[model samples]
Target: MSMNSHAAIAPSLLARIGAPVRRRAAFLLLMASLGLGVLREAALGDAWRRPVRAEFRRVLREAAGGGFSTIAVTAALIGLGLVSQAIYWLGEAGQEGIVGTVLVTVLVRELAPVLVGFVLLGRSGMVAIVELGAMQAGGQLRALQGMGLDPFRLLVLPRVAAFAVTGFTLGIIFVLIALLTGFVAGSLLGVVQLSLFGFLDAVLRAMGARDFLLFPGKLVMIGALVGLTSTITGLSARRGDSTATLLPRGFLRGVLAVLLCSALLSLAV
Candidate 1:
């Protein structure tokens, strides 16, 4: 081949090779940008306008309220089985004094945050994927853009904020439900020797200063990560992409984000 032909083919080959890298770079760039937008909205009271507040409330209700039943059912099951088993085994082993420490370390600190993350990812995150993906695929996002409205500000910012709030609130609720149900089951099975308040108090005492930060931090970070993942996945949907394509992609991303972020936060803090 001639030098000119070689040059032309080389550029084409390089473009093909760099395509995945370029896509990744773009994804990270948008993720960082959207994260900053969410932080800005959170740190500034001025960012919460009437319409934004309205949108925030709407998403909050949908995310927290809509996912409550799922959270309750999961918590109850964990409590009935895992909590009861732990109590029975510890009592039998004559190490019941450390029940609080074991439960706090294993259940509250680790499991709760990750479970809450999964719940949010499965319930609210999927909904976000569907709604946002539909908007993108239908060209409605472009129509909104032409109308001089910022979809990122009006849609994404509010939704992410709601997710963060939902994460924290729902996490606390899950912990309470799980603990209560577990205590009741243990008591009925004659495995629990302490009163209800005493059992709860022991768990509270076992929690160190770090547990306080770890619990909320993991959930909030997980929530934000899941929110961003779902939004980006939905918005990235190509024109011809169907719901079948979008859902699996969004779900895979959300699950990975929740698990990875949960693990990272557990180690970092």
Candidate 2:
């Protein structure tokens, strides 16, 4: 072929490949949003509905358990991070007092949401994806159709609710623990006043609602996105080589969604 024709053909081929990829991605996101909507609708459902109450209770229980486990893991990670910061600042005089401020900034505004999101993205998001993927591979999703059940309601709603609640709760707990750890470290090292209440007051004043609200909002958005993305990706998983590709795509898409939402929210606030 002529060089110009070859170049044109290459562009056309690339566009053809890109189009389906983009469509699939968009479809995945659409499905995730639908999952969130389903959860919202269920929450607004009947007051006298026994099934709704049972589902709500089950979701809350799962969220509490997940939040507790997430808190322990987040605390350990934040503690390690704080210790590293303390050691680094130890060599510099007159720098220890700022540790409390640093901790508050990191924990309340940045680390907590991102860390909790990542934890859920890995734990809940991945698990949902794998479970659904396995089901898809095993024809279980089709089986649900045969049984006249909407898989999104039965499978995806509970998870979306659980992840959203767990993520927001864990984010709050992570910030609280990080603040306490920073205060104790500073006091022990004589870097800050020994009063916990005083430190907390300072943090509250510095953090205003803008900083505090941004992280929690981001956590909720991340949870919602993770639930949606994982479910759609899992549902789309086909047998053979396609399943492997779908799994990683789901994870990377979840991470990117969280980062994008967090950044936008932070900027807007």
Candidate 3:
């Protein structure tokens, strides 16, 4: 081939190779931008106008209040299984003194956020997807746009904020319930002799300043990601999509996003 022909083919070949990379990069950037936009709108008092506040209150109620029993039950089971097991094994190993640290580091710091994120995603995130997906599919989004409403500000922000708030609330409840249940179970089994106050004090003492900040941060971030991923997945649906297709995709993305956010936060700290 001539040098000019070689140059032409090389550029075309490079472009072909870079196509997927470019697309992936663009998707990541878009997600990051949307996340920031949510944060910015959340910070603004004007974003809490009556309609937005009403929607936010409704979602928060549905996501957090409606799911309280389930969260409590799950936390109890986690306490019975994980906490009891940990107490037993640690006691047997003569490492009982470190029970609080272990629980703080493993159960509260890590598992609580992840499990709460999953719960929120399964309970509320899927609802957001189905609701938004139906609207998008039925052309309601177009109607809203025609009426001069910004869908992101109206629909997306409130829902995402609800998820974040619910995540934090549920996470704290999960940790407390799990620990309390574990304490009860441990006492019944003769595995834990410490008073409730002593047990909690130990755990609190083991937590560092960073843990105080990072634990809640993880919950909030995971919640926000769950909301954001579900909303994006639903809103991006085509005319051909239905709830059947949207549910599994949104669930998978929400799970991956929760885990990704948790991992990233851990790495950051």
lDDT of each: 0.89, 0.71, 0.90
Number of the top-ranking candidate, with lDDT as the measure: 3
Per-candidate TM vs. native?
Answer: 0.91, 0.81, 0.91
For model 1, how does the per-residue alpha-carbon lDDT over 123-180 read when each residue is reduced to its tens digit? Answer: 9998998999999988899999999878887788888889988999999999999999
- The reply for model 2, stretches above 4 Å from the true place, is 1-11, 28-36, 46-67, 83-101, 241-246
Error of 2 at 193 (Å): 1.1
lDDT for position 105 in model 1: 88
Off by over 4 Å in 3: 1-23
Clashes of each: 0, 0, 0
Encode model 2's per-residue lDDT on 233-254: one tens digit a residue: 7887866835568768888978
Q: How are the candidates ranked when ordered by lDDT, highest leading?
A: 3, 1, 2
Predictions: Cα RMSD each: 3.0, 3.5, 2.6
Residues 78-100 of candidate 3 have per-residue lDDT tens digits of 99999988988999899989998
Quick one: how many clashes does candidate 2 have? 0
